[model samples]
Target: MPAGLVALALGGFGIGLTEFVIAGLLPQVSRGLAVSEVAAGWLISGYALTVAVGAIAVTAATARLPRKPVLVGLVVLFVIGNLLSAVAPNYPVMLLGRVVAALCHGTFFGLGSLVARRLVPPERASRAVAVMFAGLTVSNVLGVPFGALVGERWGWRATFWAITGIGVIAAAAIATLVPYWAGEVPAGGRAGKVPAGDRTDSLRAQVSAFRSTQVWLTLAATALGYGGMFGAFSYLAYTFTEVTGFSSTDVAWLLVVYGAGLVAGNMAGGRGADHNRDLTLIVSLAGLTATLIAFGLLASSPAASVVLVFLTGVFGFASVPGMITRVTDHAHGVPLAAGANVSASNIGNALGAWLGGLAISAGLGYTAPLYVGAGIVLLGLAVMTYAAVRQAHARETHSSPNSARSPDRKASM
Candidate 1:
């Protein structure tokens, strides 16, 4: 592995830590800020929404720019955002800090994926991307827990400061260590030239990727699929404590086990995606839904809860790289749009959480969110499956004799 990929992973670590550490300290933050616990939850929604929006817009605007500057700029925004959150005397200002940090979140990952693909050979691309994403999986395993401790021992603001410093270090890692790879066309792309009046590679090359039907479906699938998981997960700490009757401290350890599952799933997804992107996606999506349902039903039992939560993590995160790879595989040369897909994932987070919250607020039980999550992921499977079938039929139809004889007709599947 090259040093640049390591730097990119470090950047991902900082981003992931900044994104999730707030959940661990929400109670402290709410008490200190004198806000309702519900109100404090906005920090999560606010950051996620901002990141989702920023991911699409920023990646598009900066799509043509050099990777190094963009990566550095994102970390700067991240550091500044955390610093502001650290010192905010008011909840509003703290949210503003989160939004600021979120603006850079999607763009960084999007660009980082592109960078990862370019850094190594084609066969190694999936693993390269996985290495960078290890930072994300590891954050769940390490960063969130450590941040929670920092907030507990020192102060919540101190935790943000620590994260801010980590952002700085990540920035340094990218700037000094990572090689400056100018964003270019991927290798083995746009090849075999406009075959017999066909333009597979050139189809709507300049059109807005967000506007494509397939892209829209893919994004919707992502938003719903992930929203389902995070919705229940956001409340896992609550469920394990009150429902399963575990000690407060034990929930933390349970989360560690969940994080371990995320790491395992992430690696599995990475390798699986390389062999069969679509198959990996289908399997992971279906597994995620099943696991959430299993977790919701069995979580009342302590031993069962532990087993289900870990399984949920494994099945849930196993989709990450495959989700991304599928989108980019279709996208080919359109790397920015690929990044926008990352934004789509976060959007799913916000939607799933909000929808899940509605079920809980309506006097539905805690397990409602898990069922809701399972439903969202199932919806993604349906959409992706439709796309898969459509692509297959289209391929078959285009290969037919009459269609091939028509000179002006473009091939589509």
Candidate 2:
């Protein structure tokens, strides 16, 4: 792996920590800012919504700029946003800070995926992307817990201050480490002199990539598949306490176990996807669906629930690398498509949580979310199966004698 990937991973860690640590400190924020708990929760929802929008908007807006500089700028934006949150005197200001910080979330990962792939050989691209995402998994495993502890001992504001410092470090690291040519497209043998016309064409190409059915299918798969796991996860605390009979304290530790599974699964899945992208996705989704079903059926058993939680985390995240890679592959490496994939994943998260909440509101038990999640993932599995078949058919058609009649058929597919 390139040393620059370390910088990207650090940026990912800081961003992930910023996004997730708020959950543990919502009460502190609520008390300090004189806001209701429900209002404080909007900080999270607002950030997510902004992420989905900014992923595509910011990425497209900056498509003409050099990648390394843009990355550094985004991290600088992250630092400023966190700093704003750290010192905000009111709830609205804090929400503004979150929205500002979130503006960089999707774009960072989307562009970072493209940059990470460029840092390594083609065959190792998926693993490279996984390395970048490892920071996110590690944040769940360690950063969130540590940030929560910091919030408890100090104050919630202190956590944001810490994240601001992290953003600064990430910004400096990215500026110093990532090569200037990281995302540059040479123009007429010139290294970085992309003409205005070429820039316009680049934007057009990105928009045009969406014409492929496979691209849309991959994005849909990312949304539904990822949404399923997140939906169940949104209600996990209830399941742990009301259904599985674990104490509140145990819930924290149980989450650590689940995070451990995420870390393990992400790395393993990355490697597996490098070997076979479609197969890894199929197996991971199938495994996740089965795990959610098992978790729902066995939630009353403490031991079984524990095991299922870990498995759920494992299978849920294991699809990420393959999902991102497949979408980018189908779109011919358009950065906008990758951003769209990130947006889709966030949309999935929000949708899954809402649906899961509805099931609980309908008087379904805590396990209802798990069953709901499983059903959603089953749909994703079906979509992915269909996509794989279509992709296979396209490849076969390209290799046939009819290839001459349509040179762009493979690209269109």
Candidate with top TM-score is: 2
Q: Candidate 1 local accuracy as lDDT?
A: 0.79
Candidate 1 stretches with Cα past 4 Å from truth are 31-39, 185-189, 192-212, 396-413
Clashes of 1: 3
Where model 2 places Cα greater than 4 Å from the true spot, the runs are 186-201, 405-413
TM-score, predicted candidate 2 vs. hidden true structure: 0.95
Write candidate 2's Cα lDDT for 260-315 as tens digits: 89988888888999999988999999999999999998999999988999998899
Give each model's whole-structure lDDT: 0.79, 0.87
lDDT of 1 by residue, 222-266 (tens): 776787788888788778877888998897789989998888888
RMSD of each: 3.6, 2.9
Alpha carbon deviation, residue 229, candidate 1 (Å): 1.2
Q: Tell me the deviation in Å of residue 247 in model 2.
A: 0.5
